[model samples]
Target: MVSDRMNSRAALWRVAAGQRGYFTAAQALRAGYSYQTQRYHARRGNWLAIDRALYRFREFSDLPAEGDEQLVRWSLWSKGSAVVSHATALAAHDLGTANPSRIHLTVPRGFRQKSDAVILHRAELAEPDVEDRAGYRVTTPLRALAEYAADGEDQDVLDGAVAEALEQGLVTRRKLLHAAQALGARAELGVERALGAML
Candidate 1:
């Protein structure tokens, strides 16, 4: 008979495989496995911890290629409040050349962080300012650029993001000013000035 530990590990493996190498403790618990048992197996080399509260099938990484699903899973660990922002957002919008070293996330004020790879910031987001992009809930292009400005993005980056916003007609100077006021001390005049130049 397979021992309970082995059985739980098998279950974890199945779930992690379905989730593209990443599964959270809550997900495993929902799958009729014990979180503590899963941790024990991970310590024993049966599983690998990825992000905080996330585990990956160790063998999955040994495979020859990466999958879009893995990126999606990492994004999910951030919950719905996070938007792929900063350098990543610029890449997404095709507005800049800088590649971010970490996964930048513009999160709401009260959301908790669950991953070391995520660089999180607090922001006030309105419902219409957010939309789904590639299975991740992200700030709209204009809102993302504004948030980037609020977070003190460099002049070139700010200019690129603002230019994209203007091209898309998603933001106006009035909108940025309102957002800047809401951003308060977190707002950077550097971003605001660049955005003004675009206007």
Candidate 2:
């Protein structure tokens, strides 16, 4: 019985191993931890609460500063339904001149969680518009650019982003045009001008 309990705890650690040592209450339950057990661990300083339902194993509290683990943690907190988007996605893809202070995430239109640390946009994202970046889901570079442009990002910033994306071959002209068109008239006009300047 003791061996079985130890194995279950080990399984929980394995589950958190891939997520920078973070895990959700639901995952802990699946790994045989009751709510009481979870609280005991937290009280014992073996786990750290990241949010209402998210936690990190104390052993991995010293993660590197440069990785997207926090973003991935937020996405997991969203139950995998949100994709990093807009300026945040631009930075993730390294395709644009974006430097967002807050993480931006796009969830389906009905997602209700709100946080001061996260900028949430509600939208329906097509599968093609989403991609995996460092294990986190994010809007593709062209899709992110179109969304950023449609949201009235600064013209100079938009232009620079478009130029950099084009220069880096992160997006082709046709795909950019298509994404722009999907964002409607204002975005199309802006993208056209940016493309013209690049040409």
Candidate 3:
């Protein structure tokens, strides 16, 4: 019995280590923790509740909350469907003058997580439009720019993003044009104007 308990604890640690010390209830169950055991751990202060279904190892409480750690946590809470996007993606790519007060996440059409700290957009993102950054999924530079333009972001910020992406070779005129066209008329026109100004 003691060996089984030790193995379970080891498995849980392995899962939590990769997720900034966080583990979901589903993950806990998969790691051999019963619901009653989870409740006992929380009551004993061995686990810190991050949300309704998420818990963190108290032993890793010293881990600094920096960089994309929070984003990764939220993505895991979202069951791996959330993709960082919009102004947040622009900031991630270092291509725009975007300063978003809230983290932006793009999920699939049926996603439903409501939180004031996060702005969630629902859309179907193709594999090419998403890229992994710092262990978190984020929209590509071109997709970020197009989404920002579609959302009616500041003209100056959009322009700066275009110039930076072009200069960094993160995006080309043709790719930008294709992305803009995919967003329809207003976005296409805005991206065109930004590209024209850069040339």
Candidate 2 RMSD to the real structure = 1.7
Cα lDDT listed for each candidate? 0.66, 0.86, 0.87
Ranking, lDDT, top scorer first: 3, 2, 1
- The segments of candidate 2 whose C-alpha lies over 4 angstroms from its true place after superposition are none
Kindly list the per-residue Cα lDDT of model 2 for residues 1-199, writing each as its tens digit: 8997899889998988877788999999999989998998888888998888789988788766566788878888898888999888888777656888889999999898888999899899999999975536999889999988887777777888899998888898899989989989888888888888776
By summed lDDT, which 10 consecutive residues of candidate 1 come out lowest?
65-74
- My TM-score estimates for the predictions, one after another, are 0.62, 0.91, 0.88
In angstroms, the error of model 1 at 73 is 5.6
- Predicted structure 2, TM vs. truth: 0.91
Task: Summarize candidate 1's per-residue lDDT along 29-147 as a digit string, tens digits.
Answer: 77666777777868997667776677777787788754245445656587445766656666566664546667777777888665667677666667787666544655566666666
State the local distance difference test value for candidate 1.
Answer: 0.66
**lDDT tens per residue, model 3, 1-199:** 9999999999999988887788899999998999999999998999998888889899778867666677777887788899999999898887878989999999999987778889999999999999985537999999999999888868889999999999999999999999989998878987988898887
Q: C-alpha displacement of 139 in model 3, angstroms? A: 1.4
lDDT of 2 at 180: 88
Clashing pairs in 3: none
